[model samples]
Target: MLNNRYEILEQLGRGGFGETFLAIDTRMPSRRKCVIKQLKPDDTTNTAPTPGWFEKRFQREAAILEELGQNNRQIPQLYDYFSEGENFFLVQEWIEGITLSQKHQQEGNLSEAQVEKILRELLPVLDYIHGRGIIHRDIKPDNIILRASDGKPVLIDFGIFKEVNNINGGNKTVPLGTPGYMASEQAAGHPVPSSDLYSLGLTAIFLLTGKTPQALTSDPNTGEILWRKDAPHRPSNLAAVIDRAVRFHPRDRFTSAQEMLTGLPGSAGREKTSVVVPPDTKILPPSRFERWFWVIFIVITGGFSFGFGHPIIKPWLDYLFPNEPTVKELPLIEPSSQINSFVLDEDGQTLVGGDEKGNIYLWEVATGKQKKTIAGQGKAILEIAISNDQQILASSSEDGTIKVWDLKTGKERITLPNQRGLIALALSSDGNTLVTGGKDTTVKLWNLSTGNLIETLPVEKEVVSLAINQDASIIVSGHSGGDISFWQKQGSNPYEPRIFPSINPWTAPSVAVSADGTTAASSSCQENIRIWKDSDWKDSPLQAGSSADICLIVISEDGKIIAGRSSDETIRLWNLNTKKEIFSYSPSSPKSFDSPRMIALSGDGRTVASNFDKKIQVWRPSF
Candidate 1:
């Protein structure tokens, strides 16, 4: 038994610094099977890092694994990590499936369609990790396992040998990866994001030709692998994409996973089935026949007006019948940069948005026209809050400052500077108090009129989200460690927080509070959405969770409706009273992986606005 709980069943394999084993957890009632990786100092190496350095590296890797596995379903889930004596071990979810290498051995070779399917499904996962600044150094057939439950590929290992870098006065370079699959730059101890793409391209080649990189012939001068002749069934377009991915120089390859995804053959042509009614269609009642009769009458009698070709008759008909007030008929607003954060006006007639390029757009939702554009902070906007009266618009950015703007004048009101970057902001209903939270692990109440700090409440962890009740008597704050705290204002010394135990540690939770302070909801990635009610904060049956993992959530003002975005690139809304989903959709025309998604719902729960890349889409949801 390892770590006094896991019973070793069989040895899986061994790498340079670690060994893996299939084990069973004795602590669980089901005796669940898992994989345990053991890491230790290798005696064969000439130079080794000190024990402190090794321990730090092990801890860092464990944290990364925990974060990646928890947020993504394509990666194996990390259950536990601990140290026993000088050896470190990691327990992970055991995927019951065969590796691509084993699949090739049994099935001969994969067809072109099969290879394309893998590329399409796995590239988004790569984009996700790369967005967080992580590069998988090893991408090979053996490292990808097709899960038995579903055929999706689950990436494993994560390059355990990459941790052995130049540390503790060691001068020799240690290049770590499989000889036949690693990129040329990776082999020289310097790997870029494109290095992983290079290996993935070669993996595709191996799946097609049933030959590893070593067996393929290469150009002597250009150093490009020549394998098109071996895979005669492949199309020229796919071949071209693969060739570019495996280019000789890193600069010549695709810079990011999103670019490579777009380079695929049919990526642009793919789209989700939309339920939105077309703009030309009219959703009218029994007066339709009367309208059609008037139309026929005007065309016949207004021939003199129509013959002039001035559209005089059409203007008269338009005055009789106005355009339908529906989201489908509204003009689409396409901004220059991705919208990072946005909030809808309480009246549901206007939308305020902040973009990645630090610009604030005030859009008229009725006509979808850009009314004003204010130059915002220098960095990407983290959060945007509209006061209850819609007079003050406050936005937080990575530049460590908050800017308050006057909606009527389209001018700046005040600038609140912070010591660190602010992540969350909330405004009181009366527009007098503003609450802000940031990486500094403190929540501050600021007087909006004077731009002065009223009070600061220090917490044990950095706050990730903040919300205030209508009366400003209750404050809901979500911390980076997954703990949601509720603070009540009693007197001058009413800053102490009533803490709830951490939900999923280190995964920031999206939280919202009702305007009346009667309801609150929060959700962490890959976890169930929890609802709390009453002053005691007891659980309510109106909870909702999904297998897709809800990442962003917003509660309606009355607390009767909630909407959120999930990891599967879909938006969903639910009615808290009935506990049923009202509507769901994939909002983008051609979905792309952009950073910092923003969503807003009208107080009446009739309108929803969301950011889809460079576009802002508004919808009057109807089932």
Candidate 2:
């Protein structure tokens, strides 16, 4: 009998709920190849009740497919869902790819880079699926297919996926995912984002080690994962991340993909890589307030003469007698010296840095040599800008001043009024316009040629970071409140701002827009960096460590290379195209700190610049 407009060719595979078939759409003489999945009639052995239950399940699956029709590239487009002689069939796009499990069998262990690339491609799809409020409970290797033509991975089989919050009342009661890959919660009946991560982690392990994870048999008294005598052949970081992901308890595993990526080797330093301060360098413990009170009492009892013998008491007494507040300790590095600003020149060839000491240094990207030093202002420099033609360098200083200098002669070309409380600055690609934000709660546009203020766009909060897209048609700014505002020139009201969705609620210290304007990266005060794509923003899959707060974010021209600095004093390189980390560097013994504050990638994506110990150092890949 014809199954709707399709004629059955041969059975492909069968599962508990349904049987999949290779079929042909015969309504047209051409007979296009298609896949049809038909729900099976319930039997005595199976508790999935008869006639009514099968029809309901079939209809539910059809509805899900209908809803997912909009995302056709990631998922097969559903054609038709109907019933024929009590048998319900679903016609869909026939995917052509080898199952991940088949790929594993054909090829040995995959490289860390390959696994990372697969994860990066798969994550965006997962994000889209999860955003629609669906949980793909079964995400084993068998369900993923790698297309031969483009070599892209695709996820198939949504039969076990359940609505994010509707799993409790479902009649499909058995455990959903594969045994070893399933998180304890999924195995015990609760499935969430963490569950999917667990499965993905296990899949990575299978691809990396060429071994299937087996059940753990613990000693009767103590519970632990039982490993064979042989160690798996995988990178230590990859192994550690997977071990944590598949832990017996959900809480023991990485909670998000971001966390897993953060822990991966080269993404963030391992726990052992932390700086160990020598005992001699440790800070002296503070004395208890009670001790101070006792000393004061003793001095009063002795008519203040006893304090002469106590040198510490003498200083304290003098301060107390004077009734003046003690001097506040100045920070070792001036706030302006913090290297909070950066600029990519018109040719993207040179980089210049301005510090709070009012000192400026120019460096050639190729040799990383200091070409010139300009010392004009006495106060700290808060921001820097380079002209599109590479003719001049502009700087904003704490003395409420903005100065423009000739690039060749290092002479002050122009100086604008001091804008007290300067926070961030940006220059248009053509270097014609300069935008500066300060404590005045406004973004000011200036003509770089004349050093004259052009327009003032008032904002509600202090702007923390600023970026201009390639065309200079749109300007994106991040505020202390963790909001990102997009300003466009073509809009009916150019001065009015539109806010992007809040992906992070803490202050984002630095922001970078891709040359193509399709992506944006922001580094936050909370040690996290978020990447915004299309209209929505998602936190980078990479996790930031406690001591390594993300301080800088930079993107390459092709929008493929992304680099960021951590409080851990290291720079991380990410390949967006491959969806894996490429390299990382932790300074040697004498120079390492808790984190690096700023980072920049050259136009060619070959060289990197970062600030440490009051100096900007350049780095290149070992290869």
Candidate 3:
């Protein structure tokens, strides 16, 4: 028995400074099991080392562990800590599951999908700890417990965590952590946030290849591990991300856990890495025909430009393409902040835009006049939706709340608290039903009139986009996991949802469904826009001739036209029946085109609106 309440059952493991033991708490009626660690001061006869320093270090690390466990569920809770003479003890929540090392030994190597899933789950935990300005100097397979209760990975053994404030040139640097798992900088006694990521990358490689890092060979020139050859079946994107994470230098590794998470396979935002070329690879000059083609094309264009100039060529070009509609830039009375989200009325007569300054601007489309300006949520707006009657406006921002405003009065009507900020919103034609998809992995339906919670539909992943059909009978949602789900209302019971897996299952997809609920479109960073038709959901291709991924898609109410904005800062419209592009517009300034919802299309698809820099550009088809 130790600490007067904990009864030791068996020894778990031993470290350089401590020994862990399995124990039970007798104070509580439940008598829960916990892991107790006994810390001892180094008895070496070195003048530099002292018992006072060891005591302070243990207390500081124990306080950090308690704080981390209380905040995150993935970390083990610290029960108690105390000093008995010169020795110290810490009791922690015992996780009842196998370690990643033991799991690997029992089940062999993990698949690419399994490795990615683990990375996604653990990165958020890393982000949480990193946000507190602490670096976990040790991250390895043996330190991670696959919790049997929920199958979630629980991070453990923060024995060598260094608070950023405690790091300075005066403090003696001591390299600590398991061999082969520690990063180069960490091994050299300077570990940053990315050093944990480096260890994680090696752990992932070990899980995938079923080989220890010590067994893996390293490049003599670059010092990069050569483990990809053993896991050759892994996707190139995943390989590239791991390679970047395990770079030799601290700056060469991912800057943060969130950055590495975004670089994961299927994420919409991918990080660019240097291309590795083989020693024997050679670059050849352009072929004779290719060289001649480029030379003749440039010469002909230059000759025509020189001969006609602007004055003569402008009229001739207008005559040759008389049907091409000219894009009109809207004039603002005052300088406006960058617009992040906007919506157009059903008739395309009015435009409502939200800017980064948390202000909403209403405009008259025909005359380019500012109708009214309303102060919105005090955060960058992410999405906005207008009521079918154009009488009500709903906007969501980064502040995690939804504000409903009266279009005519420009006064706030109601504010609904949406937990974990919404990414997509859909309003029914009657304006009575509002459907929202959020980072909470749930789609919520709310009553717009009384601001009452209606229903909650559970989804497997975080939803990125949403659309509702006429009569509020059908709802379509796209998820971060590249899933498209259809929720159909049958006689007032809870909506029955049917999930349809997307072709690109790793990226978040943007979705748009027609008012009739017969046609739907979905697109992601890894794939082109795909149109799903019929009740069974047979999909067809809609080629926009753009290689960039489409981040936002809007379909006409009648399901005849669909418009999408690609990552290349181009907005395009296509006729659903003919599958032909009506018009493609690439704005000169891409300042406001950085994210989704910066572009809006009317239900008729005749008018398109997008923000370029501080100005809104509107376009109409010339027939």
Candidate 4:
């Protein structure tokens, strides 16, 4: 049906706020294809003139688009915005090509070169967006479309976008963005330039890994991204750039897109134009403050009395106090404490973690000390991950988002959406792809470069644990049903039943794989740690143990050492080649020990670390 002079053709997409349809302009004889976005109304009793609050929001979006049109092709041109019944519709140009999300799904993870190519093109778009003081709060793969003819990424979807300086005065509302890709401040409803960088970093992660940022598990106490499996192979500079852009605190991320683009290999040494902060203006501190101050002054002047008319005392008091009280210098603010997570970058630098609470902490791995706890996040922190270069940090939280931060300047760079509470997260070896698992029960893959959700894998059962193989070819998921499923990269569904039998009636506590991907081991809460040989799955052996249960496990890259932790807080080391116990470590006093929650082994297989009750004990092989 044609609304006014526009002919509606096919529906493009539908979302919570509105619907997008591809249409043609009937007024023009040539019939040009265009896209129309219509806003859906909510229940409201007040029926005033003009438009309702939501309708006004749509009108604001229209105004933004119209303003953007001033810069040649900076944004899609808006043809019209009119009310049809109770719905508001907007029309604009329709560009062709699949979204970056599609590219990540089909390509698994993007290579460093490919990610750079895309980012080079994306940086300019961001520059334009930020130049106008506009922030794309909801930056995700679904919002970016790649032109099929030129492979250029075009960002779309402005329903939740915000203009930093054009806020309405009648109502104050929290800014909204996706969960996994939003910056800490943006998630807290304060939109800034760095928020966009956080989303862009997540987009890059999605491109490097076929998983979403929320799929990787984090240490609850530390708020750090825990990757005991395999680290993605990414260029140090590129990884650091993306990491810094998505730091937890806006202050931890790059201040501008140009700063992010500076780390690109070809763009290195190119200086970003500096922006000078405007001088503070001495203005009235709101009308209420002025009114309250005047009322107090008048009351004091009227109540005061002296022997005659208090002329002498009043003059003395006026001379002492003056007409206005001098503003006292604000006291220095004390920084708040923050929980931190740690990750080893490509160069082995100890990268700290950021949280939504505006806290950033450095991890001194050598001393196991948390240094420099900076107020980074603006709200409660959820998760944090470090890039290979130790220069970038990404954080997410209950605020419904993800953010990228720069470790050097402590600035936030990008923000992305993740409405579903992000629970687990993983980054590929290349640091280009990000995988996230959330309460939604689905594993979402993101293009970390573009802040897009590429592919979503639905696991009918609740996904309790997730691990990606070294080659990024297989994804292993441990469900609540006590079943461990192996998903191949080229399969219809990773959850499809395999010939492997269920080990226990309850979920396994932890799972690990050898670097070669030839051996798979699982530590079960039922007090069993089992291993399966690649060639014969049915011949898997279950390690005999009578402790309360196994809490964690780690397998060496060379398949030589296997470590397991029991709920009784005992560490058992085994020789994979001999299939026998090597040595066991138990505290001198059993009461002093607590169950180990997680374990990890060094590359040489000589060093091992087990965590329990916030303590990480390092062990070395005696032999």
Model 3 lDDT per residue over 411-470, tens place: 999999756756888887557788998788899998989999888999989888898876
- Worst lDDT 10-window in candidate 4: 324-333
Task: Indicate the residue-level lDDT of 445 in model 4.
Answer: 66
Task: Please give the ranking of all candidate structures by lDDT, highest first, separated by commas.
Answer: 3, 1, 2, 4
Candidate 1 lDDT, tens digit per residue, 296-402?
65566553543312223332244236322111223456777778888886545678888878888888775677888988888888788887557788888877888
- Listed per model in order, the count of residue pairs whose N, CA or C atoms clash below 3 Å is 0, 12, 1, 109
- 1 or 2, greater by TM-score: 1
RMSD after CA superposition, every candidate: 25.7, 22.8, 26.1, 29.0
Q: Which stretches of candidate 3 lie over 4 Å from their true place?
A: 1-335, 544-548, 587-597
Best prediction by TM-score: 1
Error of 2 at 444 (Å): 1.7
- Superposed model 4: Cα runs more than 4 Å off: 45-60, 69-74, 160-172, 219-232, 270-623
Q: TM-score for every candidate vs. truth?
A: 0.47, 0.42, 0.46, 0.41
- Candidate 2 lDDT over 158-179, as tens digits, reads 7442221122222112346665
Worst 10 residues of 1 by lDDT: 164-173
Model 2 earns a TM-score of: 0.42
Sorted by TM-score (best first), the order is: 1, 3, 2, 4
Task: Give the poorly placed runs of model 1, Cα more than 4 Å off.
Answer: 1-330, 491-493, 544-548, 587-590
